[model samples]
Target: MQNNKRRLVRHELNASIDVWDAQSDEHLGRLANIHAQGLMLLSDAPLVEERLYSLRLTLPQSLVGAGELTLAVDCLWVKSSEDESRHWAGCHIIDISDQGLAVVELLISRLR
Candidate 1:
């Protein structure tokens, strides 16, 4: 059965990100709200839907202690916001380390 409930709480963070195409290394854009499962990304250039990208997101030192959270994410969907200055992409977290997950949890807890 497909689980409909949210597995993790999403924390809203208009945080900057270093995103790039996993294969080509072309820069993508910054990250928006993030959760353990997925995230919203804002990009000047539209990202191809249904592609995996590598991301280096640095949480505020107060939130994550220090260092960047690196992970591979699958782009699920994309749409241009009303203003059309940026495209919002939905992404799913494909892989992350245990330590990364721990830092994310701490960030979420603090947000709550």
Candidate 2:
């Protein structure tokens, strides 16, 4: 079953990310967004659909450092936005730690 609760708690933040394309092993674009799921990368770049990836995403300033958590991710799907300017990849993160969960909780608190 899908996590239907969907937790409307979403945040927008500018962060740094390092993504290596699994298929070609090349570094892709770097960008950021406010997302509890990590970061909503902005790019029209194509990802290996349904493939798993390792992502290093910088936490928001509230976390207070350049440190980042490694996320094991699987791209659920990828679609271009209405403007056809960029693609937003819907992803699911795997195996998050308690500390990472705590940090996300802090971010949500700020949102409220």
Candidate 3:
């Protein structure tokens, strides 16, 4: 069996939080789950693995008193669903502001 090397536990998000391309403002996907280090995105198209992406997450105003959070992420992997209707991409958080990290932590807490 392959050992899991992940140090952080991922939390599946209940709400539909849209993920966007920060540069182009294109809709990339919805956040499926998140952790302190990374997140999983459910998208209509597969993201290129090993590529770095600037993502913007639209957070609920009531949750963190913020409209959006931007993050620099490195795409780790991408997989298609069984029915091939959607794609899921795993990404590593490469860069984020202190405030962004704080918001992410708060979001994880609220998820639990």
Residues 1-112 of candidate 3: C-alpha lDDT, one tens digit per residue: 7476889899997788999999989999999999879999999989999999999999988898889999999999898999998999999999999999999988888855
lDDT tens readout by residue for model 2, 21-86: 544556654534434564445566765568787765544555545366555667776767788877
Candidate 2, residue 51: Cα displacement in angstroms equals 1.2
lDDT of 1 at 96: 87
Give the whole-model CA lDDT for all candidates, comma-separated: 0.74, 0.57, 0.92
In model 2, which runs have C-alpha deviations exceeding 4 angstroms?
Answer: 1-9, 14-39, 60-62, 82-84
Query: Which pairs in model 1 have colliding backbones?
Result: none
Lowest summed lDDT over 10 consecutive residues: which window, candidate 3?
Answer: 1-10
Q: Residue 111 lDDT in model 3?
A: 59
Clashing pairs in 3: none
| Candidate 1 lDDT by residue in tens digits, 1-112 | 7454667666775445555665566667776767888877878988778887787765676665576677888888898978888898888889989897786677566754
Q: Which structure is stronger by lDDT: 2 or 3?
A: 3
Which parts of model 3 have CA positions greater than 4 angstroms off? 1-3
